[model samples]
Target: MFPTLDIQQPRPFDLVGSTILIAGNAAGFEGTLSITVSEGHDEVTGIASVGSLGLRQFQASIYIPDATAFQLTRIFVTIADDTGNENGPSVVIPVLFGPRILAGYSGWQPYTVRAGDTLTGIAQSQYGNADFQPIADANQNTLANPDLIFPGQILRIPRNDI
Candidate 1:
């Protein structure tokens, strides 16, 4: 039997656009590692070899096409140990679409950064402006650097998409 695997990247309902890194840990098995990111009719596999960390753990950084992020889609990750000698279940994550989910606020939306999040992404993607100058201004205090954003950090999205 395969030991339970823990996925550490692309949390559930995570938004996808640029190259997304898929990472996770699996122990007790040793040999090779294989990873796949699939959504609906499209799927991409690793052409390059997967690198092992220590023990049975491994990591792989993959790229999902930009077109996949244009609309709402379920992103799933699949891992195979030792070249499909055994495999783990795929869960819906790195999901596409939806600028941001309203966090029960009257005029603002709470957006937690997922795998790929940026001030420019919020502005252009959620608000439809690539410049995202308004977003930078809106989050002036926390958004000191427009180019860097990490998962789990909450950002208040202007209700007016400011």
Candidate 2:
């Protein structure tokens, strides 16, 4: 019996907003699978259903109602079988939570860096007032040095309503 799960969306170390769209392939039972997003303390869980066939595509939109409860910015997304085995076949993805950076945010806009671009300049152009911390925080996986951004490098500009 095929018993493997693969997450194709929101790759590892990605930044997720309040609601995340998780899509992947499940090679196992047609029953439901457990999808959990946890930050070591608080967690959100959902169930995804696989196709009747042994191997099928599955998608689930999980909403983190209380985003403020998580202490750590990094969260884990795990998909496992319904057998409740502690060591069963599962896929765990570690991603940065975005709401912690930009309050009430659900997504980001992509900005391509130019030759004469700086985090401060980008912040002024994107967010006004030159507060680049939010931009840097939202793209921890991409930007290693806030001051050293290369041309053609894409950055995620977090959308903040609050």
Q: lDDT: which candidate is best?
A: 2
CA-lDDT, candidates in order: 0.53, 0.83
C-alpha root-mean-square deviation, each candidate: 11.4, 2.0
Q: Cα miss at 131, model 2 (Å)?
A: 1.7
**Tens digits of per-residue lDDT for model 1, 1-162:** 644456677666444334666566654234444566665566776532333444344556766545433232345665555434444433335543222222111244578888877777777777666766544544545667878778998875654422
TM-score of each: 0.45, 0.88
When summed lDDT is taken over every stretch of 10 residues in candidate 2, the lowest stretch is 24-33
What TM-score would you give candidate 1 relative to the actual structure?
A: 0.45
Q: Over the stretch 60-156, how does candidate 2's per-residue lDDT look in tens digits?
A: 8888887796887788988887666677688889888888887787688999999999999999998777899889887787778898899999998
Residue 37 C-alpha lDDT in model 2: 90
